[model samples]
Target: MQVIDPVTLDNCADEPIHIPGSIQPHGALLAFDLEGILLGWSANVAQLLQLTPTLNTPLAALALPAEVSQAASECLDSVEDGEAPVTALEVTFGAVRFDCIVHAYHARLIIEFERRDTPSDAVAAFALKAHAAIDRLRRQKSIDALLQLATEQVRAITGFDRVMAYRFHQDDSGDVTAEARRDDLEPYLHRRYPASDIPAQARRLYTINTLRLIADIHYTPSPLVGRAGDVPLDLSHSVLRSVSPIHIEYLQNMGVGASMSVSIVVAGRLWGLLACHHMAPLQVPYSVRMAADVMAQVLASLVQSMEARANALLVEQSAEVRTRLMETLLHQDEPARALLAHAPGVCQSLQAEALIVTEYGKLVVHGDIDPELAARMVASLPAHGQDMVERSAVGDWPEALRPALAPWAGLLALRFDPATDGWLLALRREQIHTIRWAGRPDKVIRTGPMGPRLTPRGSFDEWRQMVRERAVPWAAAERLAASQLLGEMHRASVAKHVETDRARAQLLAMLGHDLRGPLHSINMAATVLQHGGAASTMSTRIQASSTRMERLISQVLDMSRINGGLGLGLTRGPVDLVPLLHDLLDEARTAHPELRIDASMPAALVAEVDGDRLVQVVSNLVSNARHHGDHGEPIELMLDERDGKVLLEVRNTAPAIPAGLLPTLYSPLKHASVGNVRNRGGLGLGLHIAQEIVQQHGGEIVYRYAASQVVFAVTLPRA
Candidate 1:
């Protein structure tokens, strides 16, 4: 808006620069340098020195008048005296109002702007007021008082009609906690509005950012064909002067003409909104809202501190109460029901209203004496067997509970153990507020010895009501209390289960060990006789049968030991396996005289292994072969090395081990049909131990069957 005259040749040469504002007759100033260069120019400089490009342009193009150019030239020339010129002017850029100031200190000039008209001392005065008020607030300890102060400060500073703390509830309802209104406006304190009035998207957007300003929510947005600017007019921000259409529609629906929502962050979370509302249309400049944002940030930490202190106090109280109750209830020798039956008395002693205990409605008990009325009240509660969970199938708490406890009154329901389906109720009595049980937080009762006020037993009706209430069944708190009480009782009732299992295990272990000693000696004697028996038929048959009986006893003992985790110790050493195999062959020759032995092992197979255990595994396999295999064919033993592991195998020419028995060959002893000597002989411990020992040394025992031949192979890590 400023116009400049052209600079003549003489003026240009005499002055290194003629700043646009100095030569142009506008409300702005400019400074030029001695190098015939315009260092900085304001809006007024546009008349004398026109800029080619708006941003970062040179200052030589304005058609300045000869006299104005001469004045600029003189100013530039005087730079030898360290003096610079300044000018002020009004300018507009793409519809933006910018008041400009230009000043040259040395080589470079500075351009400053005021987007809006300002009173010089308004800012400094505001700082003093805000600082003093905030300093006073900093010394405040009460949250309610601080909230009041902050609302007042915001209303005064912003000149808004209404400034309030709007708290968002889980149900999407909001309550105006602190409200400050203009002198003529009606009060909006303690008013609540459903959050439904603010669409879901609005809440989402509010939380997404810290500050939102709809200077005039009713403002229509100007459509742009690709607007170009650092900022637009928005409900949130205005790079250019256009608001979002969707937001405008949303605001209209909410009945708000103009609004600015400042996020109230507490405990590192968006607690709610500090909403400034104006019923009449109003426009707030960007600078004002930005200041509000800064102020909000200042108060955030203070609010956080207050919330933390309150939460800490709550936790301390809960812990103290829980400790005391647990000491009284959990470890008591008496039954839980008996212990909890006294809860109503406890509540009375604590000076509470209508002491009620609910175990999710499973167990309900009340210190209240209106037994019949209490029963009806509890029966209608959203309670089942758990304290906290209202019956989902039924109506909600406020709805169902409202009509239920209309006879009692109090505030602050003291709770305990919600996780385990139990809650203790100790309602505060000093409060005029009525805390009808969940069914009805407003339930009222007379104030006598047995009633809510707990006044002196002046009349007999109070005592009668109390006595009558004691007989009421299915009370919500009583039922819930009973449910939790029952859970505790059930647990306490069966607490000795583990000890019983341990006793059984011990018995098995003792019987197995005690009974095995005699069986072993009998088997040894029978075995010696079987191998060396003469032609005495009776003596030989007796010994053979006795040996089989001994085997059965050993099987039972082995199974008992294995099941009880009585591990057998084994010795590890280098064994010349060729001789051990030879000895085993000799034993098989004596046991299964008809069984032919085929050996393909080396003359000397040395292995770092438990030689005795290996001997047992081999012996068991031989026994299995003699009993089930070689029904008419001979058995064979093969030893070799494969994949760096020593292998020992015993094969039988029978029907590849009864398929049904092969799978369970090394499993625990079942109540199998005892008939053959082999069947009755062992409890499959040899194969079990063999597998275990080899596995201990990183080895395994496996079976490979083909045709009528069954092969039992043991693979061990080779040394």
Candidate 2:
């Protein structure tokens, strides 16, 4: 006896189970290239087929039965057309008949021959049974009903002791959702199995192969014989492929003599399995297995259809909720408050117990949950690169926070605005339950022929485990609905902001127009008093105040126009900026005598521009610096040319703007504070208007801060 290496949990997943270089003893395998030269053959082929297979010799020369030769030719034609394997041919070898299945893989044609014990007319009977089973499955209304019926029908067809409808969870673990078994046998329904029982590679193979059968778990394997230099054949698509040793041991430990699995695939993914087990060695006919495979396919299709219908219903319900939320948002001034007010509808739509909306560092929760605990949970959530975070178990949370959040086991969080740490969270309270498992999932390390390693448990008794601190899982449709709700909320919030901005602009326009007439009267009165022997100081002061008021009104009107989408009107001409800068600096000195200003520029630089608009830009920049800059430091203004473009830079010594506020700095009506003091007597539209004017001139303006110096640089084409 050969001493094979022991299988351990660490290396079991890596075991190359697909290419076992052998076949089950019940069947014989032959491999030949497209040119008909034999490449490999199972050791049992001579006994099963009554002919010896010679390496590198034409299969025709070996004198296979005429029926097999003809079937092989037809199968090759179908394989060339990209069709699946063919298994319709049966040939008589002496007195016994054999079923021949053929497929093409890795540039080789593989033929499998298995003894046929069924009647010659079994195919017609299977066809009728399959049609009736499919009709019954299609008539079922619900997925549960369909799956239950499917298990029963598969059990009746295969005559297995037990038939289970096993569902794979998102974590790859399995649950026997439905079952059909002999009345005397213990039930395996509602039992859970750990994911390690089916390794990743096995799951992948299941997806590709659709059906697998082990006729007799106690039977020996017939090894394949090939040339010395040839590699192990890829038996991924071979029907007679040998079983993995570890899997055989697993089934033996369970006292299962025969087993088969029919994959339930949906949308090209392995959704679940129809697992059949027999206590005695059983050999199911090929026709019967094919019938079970058809039923599973029908079940997969029906499951897909039912799930789609359910998801569509969820989508419609969520759409209605979103519409109602939008209407409320339109009527109310605060979006977050309106959403919270309608939280019940939103929560029900998403199947959540509570809804929490976090906006601008404020939490508005609407449900039976503690606000402080919700805040802590929100703070502890790690950033997941903009992906939605869904959890159903307390253990899925951070270890330190798990104990605190033990009472709440489900969390679905969507970050709506990452800039403001805005998030929408849904929570569900924990529900404790008990799970029945086939056995204790923990494998035991036992001494084997090779060494001590992990082995399947010997006991087949039921094991009950108490599960706590977990909630019912969120369904796929629920996740989709939550994502849609978040997106719609964002859109509604943006629309609300636009509506508010427009309303503010209209109000400003009206206020600025009304103030202009009064200012004109004040200016006229100041002019008359100065010339009519009044105190020149008083008249001058009145005139200066009126002039300042008029400029403020002009700024107000400009902001209104910009916010209203009517941009500033400009008159273009060539203007000398050197004198303009000097006059602006002189005016600034007269306005603030205590503040120092530094200037650097060319003697005379001419550019085509709206001189008044350009001055407004320069003045606003200077004023903004004075208001926000450190009073103890000097403000520097520089004008120069670079790379055939005119450059204007205004630098002020001050701390850089907060990173959080920088993104919305130039938004209209936004105010920033410097050392806890708000901007000095302005509508907070200086930078916004400046940027608008610069962009209209086909130029760009950018803000940069370094070493406590804030710089606003404007680059304009020299033309």
Candidate 3:
């Protein structure tokens, strides 16, 4: 055998692994038609069969014994569609004994004759060992423990120097989760391997052929001799199929002489593999291989059950936490406080070092975190809950926040509102660990005739690297708990507001009715004083106070009526909106000489609306713009008519409405701060009244924030 160059060997990975067209010399293969005429045979068949068989020769003409021929035909008939070749029967012809396996392939019956290597007495011992392994597996309760037991049992049964349970990640990369090996050998447990190490074709073959055995890595491949014009054989399910050259080279690089792998399948999918490797060339009897296959299947079933149980426990714990948190929130006066009250249990449930709850404009800290740092982390969280749970290393966080967050190396932050600085942060302290790797992960390349070629790394020596600036990974359970917590918080918040609104409405109605008589007397006294001109300055002050009081009282009555579902009385007429806007703009310019107002009005746009109500709506919008608009930019007012509807838009380059404030912008008594001035308000009812009046006239009012500007758009029916 010649050593193939690295580039050529690497390219061989692309070759169809299923159709190797060769078999190990320990086996002889023969292909025949359904009518029992020989179509093809392996090159070594003559040596095994002790006869020269012509192509297309009928079964009756061949020198094969009657029993072997009958068994082959029956096995071929028993093979279902898409099923792999199976050992049908054993036959001894002229002192040569073989196990004959028959399968259907491409309109032909393929029979494989493998010489049995195991003694008859070994079968009973292997069966007993299999039963013991299955009993041990049944006693295990967790997937990890079961995997450990499985690898040990396989190593004990096969007498392999080392056995490992390799589990794959979602990306096809694998990790050695469990290992049983000689004391002198370096451990491969928890060592990771890239997906490229096992090419896609190799993975597919593992599924079709659940068990593969390479007795000797350096064995020569015996070619199969097909009839004239026959295609290469597809030896995908062949027990004696020659292994890939690249895989053999890989094993050699790992200082392995022989290797065997049995696929662990769950729910009809390949879950992982029980991979066994020996320090020297070794072969196990086929009986042991069959027993190992059964053990792997049992392990697969147990693993699935254990994983499901673990998930169920997690869900149960999460539900309990959610229930307690909701109960606390529903009864507590302060929702943020309620979150803090449940912090200890939630922290334990989520497996976090600390938990932070930032809601309702208050920051609540739970454990092992700086209040300032937690606040910053909450502010940095995105507003959307779609990616509500963000897990990252502290070092990877923003540079400004890194120092404060560094102590907690891992951060898992979830936001109830992506548009607001309200979130829940789970922190995990910095973790440091030393990882022992099987070999240097770096690829070794050769500058060959091809620009570059990859070669297997030389040594399988253990390499250690100290890793830091990271945190223990967030588990799936923690993420689930966080999502559940967020949902409960949102529900509680809505319920709180609903209760608050109902109580407030009742108090307002009582206050409105009680204050009416007293307000009437004050108005009468102010009117009398103004007419008599007694204490002229006092008279003027009294009249202005009375007027302001009357406006407040009227707004309260309007709110009460609206809340009671009483429709607003609207007196509609064809009113020209252009003139109304111009008059309002003029009034605005005169009232605020320091501000600039830009107006674009159509010549004449009439709409069916109450002239008084429309004027009030325009006045309220203009006033808001003047008071809350950005000081550096002019307010823009546009009125136009198109497609039988009137469009009135009032836009101002203002400090944008804060995301947190947008939801309450048009709610009654919800005051918005203008620039830096807070509470510069006239009861906060201006926008609310304007919205109600517009809706009554069959119009729609909407507010939009764009380019650091606030725009109020009103669409109404044109006269």
Candidate 4:
């Protein structure tokens, strides 16, 4: 057969066209023209179902799947009907996906086979043809068509069951805005999934990687990382570790055998999920998966481009929410509690509840402090209990920090600004309880086991983890303002802490100077009474007063050292606790013999602490109880061993720390209960001094109020 080359650059992309390798060994060519003409034979024989140039030459036929043939015929019909000469059709051949574009000019059809792969190269070509389509959209100025065209492009290139652009809702759940898939996947057309379905651990990993593929739930899972030959190994570029096992189990439990997902981002924010599923184990070739990824990118870009205007609307809508919150915070008449009661909507706007505002230890604005779950968590970490705190397991946080907040069940600390001497904390249900992702067809980029390939996966945990890295969705106009607010809050908190500490040091310095003179005078008086003609009873009373003055001086001095940044010193060595406690107890009782004392410690208990500082810590606590808890009750000092640490606790029953004075005890500044009916007077530095001394010995002293009784506990590392 003499013939000029029919394949050209027009027949394929940049590369040379790959003609279906020679169909016949004898070289009697069988080729069709765009006009459906078999040039080797007369045109009259072209309509024959099976024909050969020579009657003796038997026709060899290739069996094509029914879907492919029908798709080809439809494309040809469109051409004959005076439509485009070549029309693209999406079709399935067994488990494989294909893109078939049919051509008809003569009496014969020339169907081109472009596998659902090389979507990047394919997009380059389509962008050229679809430039007009894109222009149509630009003219229409309609986001719907923009999304629709992008979806069709992805479907044509991926051949997945169903592809969708699912948007995240105010709740964790999402809605499907665009859908493109095989007709068989009608169930996922506009479906939704609960955010609870995707756990927190899974969300955090999504931002680092792309491409979530669950070939089959029944498929044995190999280690996501590490070398295992014959497993398509690529440690540096693997996608398994990026995927979460928990989510894989979730998909398996959900009866989904296979799943693949990608993320769609709009304006640098995670917009939605592009999800795919298969009923059985599915293994897509790298080339095919990559093609889908490229196609998804184009779709995501188009959608994002079209939604640029709508983003402005979203920003405007949030104005009301922001104003309400600002109003609540700035309200002059209403306290934070009243604000919460009258403007619940405002609190929700900040995604917080239980906001607390304090100037030093005094509560100026407080909505909810003792949140049911937050209380338990606070108790567990007493050292952190006093700070303006919030925690959440849903909405946006990492998985590593979940266990610490589990007891709180999504109670989160809002950004707190001490500059205003106020805090914004939240105690609310987790955001995951409200929102979910259906699927996002536009996102072709993600980070994970897939190594920045795609998102949406069989492992729900892995998928959610990736989502955690999602950027905040505040619009550009709002972002600057939001950042300013967050910064202001942080700066305020730090400024307040500094001011409180500075004032506290000044008071202690003055007290240290003033009290020393009187303290020395009292000691001289006591000494004279002891040896003078004065009675022994008079000597004891004088000595007691002298000791009280000494204690007040020591409290003042400890505060000065801590405030001056002297910090703690280390003298690491084994030290016996029994002798330590007994000696300190003797000195304490000598100062106030009338106060009862009890000590419990193991005979051989020892720890690593500064001996002199430890002594001071114990003595200070005893002295504090002697003065504060003057109810004539025995003060209990409990020492026990737990978790390899020696615990020393001082217990006393007395008037509570005047409620409002609780926090200022540690604050450098002295805080008095504003209008407490109970008359209590003290600089509130006893516990602060004791805490510093204990810490210098590498220990911690904590105080807890139990109704009328206040317990001060100190723990040191056991050696």
Candidate 5:
């Protein structure tokens, strides 16, 4: 047996585990060029095939059976360029039958030959077992359940003393998540192993070759030989590839004489491993290994589906929360207050302990946290680069700030503006617990011929450590949700600013157009009257312009007072609608003589209301109707009382309001007709003020389009 000294083993990371230069003695490996010129052959090949390696020797000279040669050619042709090995082919060479697995690597055709001599009965039995195992794995609904089922099924099929399902962590380290073994053996479940245990090259090999078995650690490696040169063979896809000496030593230290590992691949990446171990040298049949490989593939597919489904659901939920938050923020005047209002929902939905929003030197915190410390941290955080950062452990944070953040171990933060120090941070509290490790996980160095070499720890005994100041790691879903929240917040802030700027511009325009224009006309008319030029006409124009200016000013004041929370100061009294309607009809006829006016009402319909405010509501509604109504269509008003409620309808023939603009019709200062078919503009508060007054009287004003007519409908309690 060859014992690699500590120096060679120490450089395990640089070791080319893929090109071991040798292979297990039980199988033969052959490498040839595209023209059938023999390039390389394992030392065991001569004994197995009665052929020796020679420079530029054609593979056909060996006289391999026609069927076997054709199968080999077909296998190579079927494999696409740069793809993994194709399925193995059963072939006969003399009296020995073998499974011929062919693949191309670095412009060389490499073939592995594994001897197969199982009886027909054994083959049939193994097939049944393989099918049962696949069926059992398929029934598992979740990734965890599937892994557990895989471990148990592989153990039963391979008959190994211990079987464990090990999963890789984000840091390349791995943990034994599920295990099934003999009752007397120690359990390896939940035990974490350092990344160094499996070298980088070894991990790459695991992805290429899904199943690997070491039937006997003590068996000698048969070196591949060529006619000339010192070129080594590449055994990357060889099932009977020789084991790495360092790995052999590690297994020996752990009292494992034989082992088999099957890679669990998800979405083309190595996700984990199903490792089988035995205390004594044991040979696992090729059939059993094949069955284990099939099971691993099936499990990998199921895991991918489950994860995809989970991610979709999380995305949908995050979108809903984002929509709700944006709607609330758009309606708010202050961003800080808006975020505070939805703080609880945000925290709960994100599964966070606390939430913080810091902007422009202002800090608002929503849950358990040290406000002063959080403020300091927020100020110190980067104001550029990545928009989001998530960390499960904050141990590397500054020592000065550690005490303040000691209670929390995880953080998810999103910056709304990369150029500004504005952030939305979600916090997670620290979790302290005990964890079991397979060993001390500390690398050891030993003196060797070449200075020293790093080696795996000598002990496999369980080591218990108390883990502290570490919170539950933030999952990909939570990070995605945080990103979505930041996007929505940014949009809301932009929209609010736009709306604010627009409203300000509109107010300025109202002062310039409605107030200034009318006042200027009146002033010009007064000058004309003073000069004795058409005094009657100028005087009439002055009176009409002044009245229009007064009405505009009064409406502006009413909207301002209502928005400022001032009560409308209504005096309840017995008001007669019939007399009021008749007076309003006469006034409308005088104001808009070109259009006809229609009114429907009871002879004596009376209700308790503020006579002045109710009259103002009616006046505003009637004026709006006359201005926006079709030029040739009559304006209609209907008022009635039933079931202790007063119903009022103002209808006119006009183009239907755009669906998108209808919701904003009752909003203060919103011009629903800005770009519509009719653009007669005002302060845009006529319907707004009317709706406010009716609500004060315990009523609602609704606008709807029906039968080619636009209608303003108000329903009020008779109070």
Candidate 6:
């Protein structure tokens, strides 16, 4: 009933599993130097090969089979350092034949002789079986199907009693996802095993060596007899490397006499394992194990493909949701409010239960989340440079917030604006579920001949536990989607800021130049009246200045309303264009005596329209032409009907607008600077307001520049 000490359990991770100092009893190992002199041999090599071993003896003097000697020489010549063992040749000793596996390690040529149990002709059969298995696996459309097929194929190829596909989780624990076994054997599918079952060092070796076998768990380990000062031989890549005693005891407790594992590596990481177990001692031939290894690799590749495809589909869906959210942000005056309105959809896309949006330290939550708890969670999150932070376990959160966050164990926080502390957090409620572990997942310390050592648990009966205070793990696709949404939010924020700055600069410009002119004229007229100058002349000047100031104020108000998502307040009525045009021309002529204006129109042309709003449109267009047009050329106005629609065209001779500025030509507060001819005494809202008024009347306004002439045409549908 002794429990392992915490320190000793931590020390287990540093075990020298690679240099085990021995080989399994199924094989005999021999180590030689470059000069063909024997350096080390396993203790049972004399009994296995019937050849007495001698230290510092030349290999040729051992009187071994001629083929074995030649094959060992060729292997030493061709094998590179640190390479995995290669099957060099097959030779017979007395009546039994063995396969020679050779590799070079640390200036020594090591060879392992494993008994050849399968007939030589079985090699071709194994090759054909592998090809068929891979073809069948390729036909599977999902990871589950592929895993099931893989386990079945490995069992079929190796004749093991049980084969299970054990997939590793983010926590390093594993679950048996798929299984193929004899009818009398108990099922292990969906059973979980703790990370401590496979220590860190053993997992590292799994990545280095793709296949490992324990032919007989009860067999004695043949100790290597090397020179007095030599270090323990590194069996990291050895096929016959002895199994760890802890692992051996664990397998024995499970009633497994033999076991083999093929590593499933994806993108250079150990993704899972193809674990095979037999009820009795089983020696699988090297050729057959190679076939199983190939299948395992194929399974890894297929799993990767299936996962990538699913993730891609999720990303596409998330992008659609993001596009809709962006539209809301751009159209509404308050972006945070708009986002909160669509919180449910966002949460669904992110696979979360609730959403929290924070702007300038104010929190707005959608769903059944408490505002106080949400605030605490946000405050407790450490400031990170990354735009997105994801946490699934309660312990992963800051200690101060863990107690409050217990109910909501998962968090995906996207920081859209670091300056304003704006964040969009998606939360998942704690999901309490039961796990069926193969055992209690605890080990004990036992004092044996090797001193105090950590031993595997003796019992492997099914054990169930209820796990709480943890949420279901988030998928990679969800994180990717969150990151993408963060990027879009950042871009939208920058655009909003740019527009704000531009409007601010325009407002200052108008206040300094446009309004000051009228103010100065009114002031001068008032002073003259006060000093007893001609009252009629001073009154006329004051009236003109006051009218100009009123027009500027009206234009500013109109722009503000349109920008606030409010359309123009238009009153519809029928109005004749001929008189309106004539009267407008008379005023323009009187106002600018040095300018020439020309007009053409059909008599009595009229339509359903907002008369006052139409007047503003026409007046703005004429004033824009006068200010920006070439002064030497006559301004032309035409009123006519075309294609059953009323067409009003205002033409002026001016240089074409710059290409870069054309896109923003009708945007509020954006004006063109053409060769120092500034927009004299007017805000840049004329065209934008004109477009809005025309559209409100079910018409469209278009601008064209051709042959040094700028034309703005309003097309109104005839009622």
Ranking of candidates on lDDT, top first: 6, 2, 5, 3, 1, 4
lDDT tens digits, residue span 621-667, model 6: 99888888987799999999999899999999998877777656676
- Identify the leading candidate in terms of lDDT: 6
Quote model 5's TM-score. 0.70
Candidate 1: regions farther than 4 A off: 1-115, 119-121, 227-257, 279-285, 335-364, 369-394, 397-719
Which is the winner by lDDT between candidate 2 and candidate 6? 6
Candidate 2 Cα misplacement greater than 4 A, ranges: 1-10, 80-84, 228-230, 381-387, 398-400, 447-452, 497-719
- Residue 10: error of model 3 in Å? 11
Report the lDDT of model 5 for residue 713: 86
Model 6's lDDT to the true fold? 0.83
TM-score list, all predictions: 0.40, 0.70, 0.64, 0.37, 0.70, 0.72
Poorest lDDT segment (10 consecutive residues) of candidate 6: 671-680
Order the candidates by TM-score, highest first — what do you get? 6, 5, 2, 3, 1, 4
Q: RMSD per prediction, one decimal?
A: 27.7, 18.3, 18.1, 19.9, 10.3, 9.9
Best by TM-score: 6
lDDT of 3 by residue, 565-680 (tens): 46467888888778777887787787569889888887888778899888889887877887777775898888888788888889998777777776556666553432125323
Write the residue-wise lDDT of candidate 2 on 1-719 in tens digits. 97766666656677788888888989888888777688889999889888777889887787788878887777676665344465557777888787788887767788888887888687668768878999999999998899899999998888899999989887787899999998988898888887778887788889888889999999899999975116788888877888788789999988889999999999887789999999998888887888899899989999999989988887898899989987776654435556787888888888998888876555778888788988888887665576478889998888888878857999998876564466888899898888787888788877778567677666657898898998989988898898898787777667766766675775476456545655776777667776784566656766675776776678778876754446688788888889988998999989789878999999999888888899899998998888889877999999998888889999999989888776556655553531125453466567778887897788978899977899999998767
The clash number for model 3 is 3
lDDT agreement with native, every candidate? 0.51, 0.81, 0.75, 0.50, 0.78, 0.83
Please write out the lDDT profile of model 1 over residues 482-588, one tens digit for every residue.
34444443454344234335534644564465446555655655676778854366455555656655654554555445333353455678888889989978977
Q: How well does candidate 5 match the true structure, expressed as C-alpha RMSD?
A: 10.3
Worst 10 residues of 1 by lDDT: 462-471
Tell me the lDDT of model 6 at 200: 93
Candidate 1, RMSD to the unseen true structure: 27.7
State the lDDT of candidate 5 residue by residue for 1-719, as single tens digits. Answer: 96765444338788878778888877788777766677878888779876666767776776666765775576556556633355566667788877777777665777778776765467568768889989987888878888988888888877899999999876677899899999999888999987888888898899988999897777799887783125766667778889888788889888898999999888777889999999987766676688889889998888888988988877877777777778767764435545777887788667898888865455678987878878876865665687787777867555677777878878888887443256888888888887687999877787667556777788988988898888888776777788779888877767766785788688777656767778889989988877888978887888888888887788878866764446476788888888987897897798667868888988988888887788788888777777788888898999998788999898989988787666466665675543234544476777778877897887878888899888888887876
lDDT of 6 at 249: 87
